[model samples]
Each structure stands twice: as C-alpha cells, then as structure tokens.
Target chain A: MMKYYFSTEKMSVGYHGQPLIENIEIALDKGEILTLVGPNGAGKSTVLKSIARQLSLIGGTVCLDGKDVEKMSGTQLSQNMAVVLTEKLRTELMTCEDVAASGRYPYTGRFGILSDADRLAVREVMELVRVTDLKDQDFTRISDGQRQRVMLARALCQAPQILILDEPTSYLDVRYKLEFLSLLQELCRKKGLTVIMSLHELEFAARISDKILCLNGKYMERFGSPEEIFTPGYLSHLFSIETGSYDEENGTMELEPAGGEPKVFVIAGGGTGRNVYRRLQRQGIPFVTGILFSNDLDYPVARALAAEVIEAEAFEPITQTCLERAKKRLVECERVICCKDSFGTFDRANEELLAYAKHIKPQLIVQTNFEVIELDQKEQNKSQEQKDHDKFNSVTQKSKVENQNQTHNVRKEGIAPINQKR
Target chain B: MQHRRKMRYTAAFLLLGIGVLAAVALNVCIGTVEIPLADILSSLRGQTIQNERILWDIRLPRTLAALILGGALALAGYLLQTFFHNPIAGPFVLGISSGAKMAVALVMVFLMGRAVRVSSTAMIAAAFLGAMLSMGFVLVMSRKVEQMSMLIVSGVMIGYICSAITELVVTFASDAQIVNLHNWSRGSFSGMTWEQVQVMAGVVAVTSAVVFLLSKPLGAYQLGEAYARNMGVNIRLLRALLVVLSSFLSACIVAFAGPVSFVGIAVPHLVKSLLGTAKPILMIPACFLGGSVFCLFCDLLSRILFAPTELSISTVTAIFGAPVVLWVMIRRRQERTA
Candidate 1:
C-alpha cells in the first residue's frame, strides 16, 4: 500500500453532539491538497474544523503520520499541523509581525519571546506571502486581502507538515484568490505540506486541489481526485442549483436562459454570437442560435443562454438538415440577427439561409451590431416606448452622477450638504 | 524600526519608574503632620526623633500597602481582561473584589461574634474563597452569553449582589466591630501595619512573578482562546491559572484594603495606551508599576484633600478611574465605527 501521510477513518462531525456529516473517510499522501466543497451550511466547515481539531469529533479516528491525532499532545499536534480558521481575528494593538510571530508559540522560551531563528522563520513566511512590507502595520488596519495573506503567513510560520484552512479565499478578490491558492500549491510542492481546506469557489478548488471531497450537509457525497469529482451534472445536483448552470470542463458559470418560444433568430458562428446571446438573455428575450460547430468557442454560451441552439459536428460542413432546422427557427422568430461578418466554404449553407431570410422578408434589417430589430409597426411602437424609457433612465443616471460629484466635492471641502447646512 | 520600538519601550519604562518614585515620595512627605525633610531623612537613617513614630508606623506602612496592593489589583485586572478579552473587565467590574469583600466580611463577622481573632492568613483565605466563587459565576455567565458586554453587565450584577450581602452582614455587627469594618469596607489603606505589609508584599510578589512567567501564553491568548489553543497553549490550564491568579491578587487587595474600585480596570488601560502595545511580556510589569503609581497618587489626594477629614480611597479612585473607563468605552466604540 502507498504510505498515506494523513487519513480520517469513519469520522463523524457535528456541533453539540449531533452529527451532521458521518462516516467521512479521507486519505492523502504527504504533499497532496484535499479540498471540501459544497453549498453554504453543508458541513464543509464542520468537517474541516474536526480535522483541524478545532472542534471535537463526534466519532471516529484521525491519523497523522501513522499516529492517532487524539493520542498526541496539543503541542505535538500543533507542531505537526497549523490552521487558518474562518473566524475573524479580533486582535488589538498587534502588528503583522507580531501576529505572524505568534505562530512560534510552541517553540518559544518561557516568556514566549521570539528567538533569532524564529524571527527569521517569520520573515521568510511573510516574504513568501508578499506581506514583508506590511510587517510593521497594524494587522487590523490592513485590507482584507492583505489580512488574509498575513494570516496565511502566520499559519506558514508554524513550520507544520499539515495545513488546514476554512474558506481561505472567501474574503479575497479574484487576484488574491489566485495568488493565495497558487501559494498553497507552491507550499505543497516545495515544503511538502499536506493541505486540507474548505473552499467556496469550486473553480479554484478544481484548479488547485489534488483531491476533492463533496459534502451535502448529511454525508460525504464523494471523495476522490478533482478529475473524478468535477464531472458533468454532478456539481449542479450537489449544490441544488436551479437558477443557473455550471460548466465543469471550462470552469465557467452562466445565468439561467430566458424561457419562452424563440422570438429572435441569431445566425452566428465562429465565436461571434457569445455577446449577442448574453445580451438577449439579460434582456429576457428568448433567442435561438444556429450554424455553430460543436467545438466553436461560443457554443457553450449559446447552449446555456439561448432558448435553442442548432449546432453541427466539429470541423463538419453545414448540412441540409441543419439548414432546414435553421429555416424553421427563423420562421418562428419575428427577427433574424446575423452575427457573422463574412462566410467561409463551410458556412455556405448559412449564407444560403441568410439569402432565404432576405427574400422572404422584404424589410430585412441587416445590421453589423446585434441591435434588436422590430418586425412590425406595432413592435416598432414598443421599441419607441423602450427608447423613451432608456432616455428617462439616462437623465436619472446623469443626475445620480452629478449628485455623487457634489457629495465628493462637499466632502473634500469639509462642508455640510446644502439641506443639512440649513 | 525594531530598535526604535525597543527605545520607546525603554523610555516608557523609565518614565513609569520615575512616576512611581515621585508618587511614593510625595505620598510619604506630604501628610497632616508636616515633618521637615531633614527630620524625615534622620528617621530614615534610624535616628528616633519626634516624627519617628509617624513616619515608620503611620506613613510608611500605609504608603507601602498602597503600592503593593494597588499593583496587585492592577495585575489582577490585567489578567481578568486577558481572560475575558474585554477591555472593561477588571476585579471590581467583574464583582471579584466584592466577592472577596463578602467572604472576608462574613468571616470577620462570624469570628468577631464568637470573640475570635482572625489571622492575616485566615482573612486572605476567606477573601480568596469569595473571589473564586464570584469568578466561577462570571465564567459560567461568560459561557452562556457570548457578548462581552453582557458578561460585564452580569459581572456588575454579581458585584451588586455580593455588596448587598456584605452590607447586610455589616448592618447587624456591633458598633465596635463596625468601626473597623466600616472604614475597610468602604476601601481605605489606613491602619496597615508593617507585618500586614510584609505578608501582602510576599503574596503580591509571588503572584506577579507567576503572572510574568505566564506572559508567553497570555500573549497568545490576546488573539483569543481558539487561536491560543491552536498555538499550543492549553486553554483550560491557562484559563484556570488566570482565575486563580486574578482571584488571589484581588482577594489579597480586598482582605487588606477592601474592594478598592477602578484601579484594577483603569491602570492596565492607561499602561497599555502609554506603552502603545498590549504585549503581555511588557504589559505585565508596566501595569504593576502603573497601578502602584495610580494608587499612590489617589492615596495622597485622599489624605490631603479635606485636611482634617479623610476621604475614602474608592471615592478618589472612582473620581479619577471611572472617567478612564468611560474613555475606554468611547474609544472602543469609535474604533468599531471607524
């Protein structure tokens, strides 16, 4: 058997003696990353807390380096494992250096004074997390992103073989999220630190985790490699997501499409209809898109946002059957939108279809941009009303902008508002 | 930058030391019986003079008691604040002093009823039991209510209850016993003998030294209990040590001087603000000094403010210390909003 560095067997975790998730078994090698991912309140944090020993396990045994974790003393366990919890640190009058140096608690002298070697370790970890410049700044005064980095540095300074974090990237923006996860990857690679953390962002978890555990509040839904866990139709079912769709392969998400019969037909191909499909979706206008190859860059977005997508096989020429289907959708739609600027030999059928649309409908609006075109005079009146509404919105938006400017100027000059001044 | 911080710490310590020396000197020199500096000097040099009885017996013991017991109170306050992670937490605010007062009063009343004399150790033991009882109640309340404000409120309620009980016991005592208990109950450092000073100094010194040794874990504890546990500090043991040490300090103060108000709370906050950091390693000794300085000043004011009539030490401490507590609250509110 391959040697496992950390493992939990038949572990049950909960609060106040009531088990929320039971029989969770996880095994990992020395340098692997295990991520727990689920919806909110799905016991991801509960399991992570139990593994970190922040909470008492309801049942079962957690083993580290072939030793039972419960059997080890707190100091020994702390030397082996370090954790960054979700609870906000309410530290007062502490510098970032002080916060990070606290990780040396187990190694310090009787007075908890940091040694030169301990200081070097703190410096090294702070540098690793790019928080060396913030060493003297108050921990509470830093931005959330910087604070998370400092917390990671604190955990790193523990010099542990295992690291556990609960939603470490929850407060971080996109760039910091990427940086934080990448730093974890580096730690795993360079220091051989085995990381077990719960993550809210499934995309980051998929990209960064070596092993993934799916939780659903009642049980460990699945535990395997990221490739095994992130599959088609699995995440949607796990999260019970009904309002949108998640793309496991590309790690993208799309809002729910407008649900109605196709009122707008988009003749698009070669990644041209991506923006048009999203715009129509945003406007709640049901649309149908066609003549897209299965491997087209815009195919996933169209499939996600369009009421219907007519597609061909990758690298296959447009066929007669696809043209017939497109014609039927075009007839059903009151307007046809051509997103392509030019056509190739493979799109000869789409060209023929466009010609058919122009011949059949005399008032065909051939627009380069994907602006909505009304079919009848009555629809044109509706567009006129929409234009008036847009004009009104613009006036209000301008006034809001001017109000913001006035407030900014007043604040800069340290003056009260006009009404408040009276 | 570290060198600059170290220099600042050194300067602060020097300033506090000087302030303590000045306060002690003023406390000893300025009294109702205005002994000349030359006479005081001779008395110090073992020349038994006209003012010798006043200096050695009255001024010296009272001033020493003020210093030792005041430092003990502040150290106890620091430990309680750290334990609760509440800036306003202190021996008096947390009802610990009142609890000690109640126990000591009960013991005094019971022993005096039987015409029995209580030893200094017996009084300390009684006061310690009372402090532990109140601390236990507060700890249980803290677990039930996660809000620090609620914990403080509950602690104040406990203080009121303990004080009421102590008053009831004092109410039924005979006039002769009440004469001595009355002054001590309202909090005064008067009538402290040299023997009592030695006992209190020994207790306070040993306790403060243990607190200093615990600076490492106490520093970790400032991050909160969960983080302290993760940092390998035994949460249970540290908490237990905090309760015992704080109780011992406050019990000693209550047994000697009787529930002196606000010094326990105010001194630590002032010391922390002056030092510009909350590192327990620095704060433990600084707070002790700050407490000594604060009490010495208050005691001096109490002695000379009304000339012939003396004011209670609690009255002076509340006049000075309550405002600091209010300032702490206001600053904390602003910090939250900011």
Candidate 2:
C-alpha cells in the first residue's frame, strides 16, 4: 500500500454543522495537483476552506505529513499550508509588495516586522510570480490577472508545503487563466508543493490536475486520476447536462444538437465540414452529416451537431451499404453541402456520395466553393463604386438605419456572416 | 522608492512633533494672563513667575489631560476603523463615546446626590461599561448591515439616543451639580485636577502600550478577517481585543473630557493620508501624535479664541474636524462613482 503524503479520510464539510458533502476521501503525494471540479453551489469552496482550517470540518480527520490538522497549532498549520481564497482582500493603501510581505506573518517576530530573510523570501516569490515590477503599485489598482498573481506570490511567500486555493482562476481572463495554471504546475513540480484548488473550468482541471475530484449535490461523485475521472459521458451524467454534449476526451462542451427532423445533409470528412456543422447547429437547422470514418477528424463534431450521422468503420473500405445509406439520406434533405474540394485516397466515399446526390437532384447541390472568388470580387466592386459615389458627394439610395435593420435580419435569419456569400 | 517612503514617514513624524511642541508652547504662554515665553521657561526652571498660578494650576493640568485624552480618542478611532474596515468608524461617530458619556453622567448624578466624591477610576469604569454596551450594539448592527453608510447612520442614531439620555440625567440633577454636569456634557478639557490627570495617564498609558504590542495582529486584521486568520492571527481574539482596547481608550476620553467630536474619525484618517501608508506599526504611533497635535491646537483655540467666554473643546474640534470627515465621505463617493 502506498503511504499518502497528505490525505483526508472520510472527511465531511459544510456550514454551521449541516454537512453539505460527506465522506470525502482524498489522497495525494508530495508534488501532485488535486483539483475539485463541480457545478455552481457544489461546495467546492467549502471543502477548500475546511482543508485550510477556515471552516471546521464536520467529520473525519485531515492528516498532513502524518500529523492530524486539528492537533496542529495555528502557527504550525500556517507554516505548512497557505491558502488563496476567492474573497477579495480589502486593503487600505497597501502596496503589492506590502501585501506579499504579509505572508511572512508566521515567520516574523513581534510586531510582524519582516527580517532580512523574510524580505528575501518575499522578493523571491514576487519574482517567481513575475510581479517584481508591480511591487510599488497599489494592490487594489492592479488588473484582476495581476491581482491573482500577487495573491499567489503572497501565498508562495509562506514557503508552504501544501497550497490550497479556492477558485483561484475565476477572476482571470483566458490568457491569464492558461498562464496561471501553467505557473501553478511549474510551482508544484519545482517545489514539490502539494496543491489542492477548486476550478470551474473543466478543461483546465482535466489538463493540469494530477488527480480530479468530482462533486455534485451532496457527495463526492468520484475521485481518481484525471484519466479515470474524465471518462466518456461522466461529466454530462455528473452535471446532468440536458442540452449540449460534452466530449470527455476533448474536454470541451458543444452546442446542443439542432432538434427536429433532418433538413440539411452535410457531406463531411477530413475536418472540412467542422465549420458548416457548427453553423448549422447555430442556425438550429436539424442536419444529417457524414459518411465519415470513425477515425475521421470531423467524426466527433458531426456526431455532436447532426441529427443523424451515417457512418463507416475506421481504416476500412467504403462499403456499398454505407454509400447507399448516404444516398438515401442525401436525397431526403432539401440541400446538400459538400465541404471538401479535391478528392484523395480516403475521399473516394465522399466523392461518390456527392456524385450520387448530383444525379438525383442537381438543384440541391448549392455549390459554393468554386464561385466564392467571383462573389467576393463582385462585393468588393460594389463597395468601391459606393465609395467613389460618396467621394463625388452623391447621396445613398437607402437609409442607413434600414440597411442596418436588413443586416440584423440577415443575422437573425442565420445566414453565414463571413466568407459564405457564394 | 523605499527610501522616499521612509523619508516621507520621517518628515511626517517631524512635522507632527514640531506642531505638538509649538502647540504646547502656545497653550502654555498665550493665555488670558500673558506671561512672556521667558517667564514661562523660568517658571519651568523652578522660579515662580507673574502668572505661575494661571500656568501651573489652570493651564498645565488641563493641557496634559487634553493631550492624553486626545491621543486615546484617535487611537480608539483607528482600532474601530481597522475593525470595521471603514475609515469613518470612530468612537464619537459610532456613539461609543456618547454611551460612555451617558454612563458617566448617570454615575455622577447618583454620586453627587449622595454628596459622594466621584474618583476618576469610578468614572472611567462606568464609562467603560457604557462604551462596551454601545460597541456591542454596533458590532451586532455591523453584522446585519453590509453598507458602510448604513452603519454610520445607525451609529448616529445611537449617539443621539445616548446624548438625550445624558441630558435627561443632567436635568434631574440640582443646580450646583448642574454646572459641572453641563460643562462635562458639553464636552470640554476644563477643570482638570493633577490627581485626575495621573489616573488618565496611567489608564491611557497602559492601554496604548497594549495596543502598540498588538500592532502585528492588527496589521494582519486590516486586510480583512479571513486573510488575518490564514496568517496565524487569531481573528476572534484580535477582534475582541480591538473592541476592548478601543472602548477603554474612548471611555478614558469620555470619563475625563466627555465626547470630543470628530477627532476619533478625522485624526487617524489625516495621519494615514499624510504618511501615505496604513502600516499599523507606523499608523498607531502617527495617529496618536496626530491626535495630540490636533487636540492641543483645538484646545488652545477653544481657550484663546473666545477668551473669557470659553467655547467648548467639541465646538472647536467640530469646526475643524467635521470638514475632514466630509472630505473623506466625498472622496469615497467619488471613488465609488468613478
């Protein structure tokens, strides 16, 4: 049996003696990352707060380095663990450096004055977080991303063995979110720091966390390595997703599939039909897509957005039955959209399917690829003429508001907004 | 940048020190009986001067009480501000001083009715009880109301109620008792005996020293309660200590000089602004010195401004301090809107 570096055995956490989540058994090694992922109001924060000793655990014991957390003095706990919480720090005219320097509280002597070593540790952590330039900036005045970084630096300045963060990435924008997680991963690796944090972003949790803990209504739904926890259909089951589908492998959620009977047939393969699938999904027009091999790049996307996906086995010949099924589905649709242009070895099935559709109903083909250049040129010429007319002080024929209303109507009608005029 | 911050702190302290020295000198010399500066110096050198009676007996004890009580009031205000995380929180504004005043008034009336002499200790003890009662009410209200303005409005309401009760107690007193009660209720630094000064000195000295020792946890607590607890600071204990210390300081002020208006809120705020930081180690001392300077000058103006007919110290302090409070509120509103 592996001896855990830190673990919670049958832990229960809640507010005011009412347990929201119970029997949370978590085990972690020295330098691993554990992330709690759940829907809103899933008590992710309550668990983190409990582990940080901000909230009393309702049941069970949290052992850190073989010592029970409740038995450790506050100073001992603080010296070993530090927390970054979602609650905004209410500061008064404190510089970023001053805020970060406050992490020395456990180490500082009387009056909480920073010694030379304490100052050095603060500086090192600030530098590690790339916030040395922001040392003199007011903590309140900084951007949210920088503020989170400064808070992380403050926590790191504690030189803690275990770091607990409560939804630390909630305030960051996309770029900062990636950067923050990457920095956290780096810290865990380099410092052997055990980390536990709650994150709403499942993609980051899946990618960054060594172990993933899933939480829902009143229990720990599952806890395991990310590989075990992020299995297919688990998230949708855990979150009770009704509309949109989530691909556990991709760690991404897709728009709900267009409902009702199929109207459009998308001849999709080799990543070509990805855009049209999403466009059709957004248009809420039920679509039937494929004749894609199971291993095809667009297979999963087609399965997500289409009402029915006609299929083929991976690395196998295009069967006569598969092409016949595609032909039947193709003819039943009002229009056929083939996204691929040139045919190749694997493109034989799509080419055959397109040919069969053309023979049965030529008007349904709606070929857009070849004429796109001419359409773009025509639109640009029209715009040039308008500009020249304006230069000559000529008034437009239509009111601007009427034109704007028409554009909005086109958007509402779900016409493709970009590069699809043909 | 660090060097400049240190220099700014040094300069701010120097300015406060010089202002205190100047205010004390002016208060000592420029009284109704103008003994020249040299005569005052010689009097300090043990030679009796032309107005030794006015300087030593009248002005000296009163000035000392003002200095000590003023410092205590501002320190009390700083602690309350830190507790609430609102710069406007103070003893006078939060009705803490009024509560102390009410209790002191009731005790004085009952004692004087029996022809019993009220010692400074008894007055301070009574004031502490009253201050803690008001503080407890404010603490309860603070939990219910999230808005800072609502807290202040409720505190103002509490102050009015306490002030009314104090006045009612004074009204029931006899005419001879009424004179002393009136001056005390009006809030002044008058009629100070050396014995009373010694008592206040002892209480304020020990309390301020305890407060200074708590500057470490107080620093962490300023960031808010959760972070303070995470920092190994016992948040509940620190909060309790803050309430007790600040109430004791304000109770001492109320016991000796009654409720001097606005110094509790205004002085700490001005000092924090002047120093360009809110580090508790720096703010605690600076607020004390700032309050001393502010009260000394305000006390001096109260005496020499009206001369024979003395303006109460609260009136003088209000004239100066109320605008600072207004300025703070306006700035807060601007920041919110911006």
TM-score of each: 0.91, 0.93
- In model 1, where do residues sit more than 4 Å from their true spots? A364-422, B36-41
lDDT of 1 at A336: 73
Instruction: Specify the highest-DockQ model's number.
Output: 2
Model 1: per-residue Cα lDDT over A1-422, one tens digit each: 77689999999999999999999999999999999999999998888878878789999999999999877788888788888988887688889998988888888878878889999999999998889999999998899899998998888888899999999999898998888899899989998999999998988889899999999989999999989998888999999989979988778899999885666788887777777677667666677888788888999899889888899988878789988998887876656777776789888888887888776763444333333233555534544554566576888556445533442332233122221332
- lDDT by residue for model 1 (B132-214), tens: 99999999999999999999999999999999999999999999889988998999999999999999999999999999999
Please give the distance, in angstroms, between residue A116's alpha carbon in candidate 1 and its true position after superposition.
1.9
Clashing pairs in 1: none
Q: Which of the CAPRI classes, incorrect, acceptable, medium or high, describes model 2?
A: medium
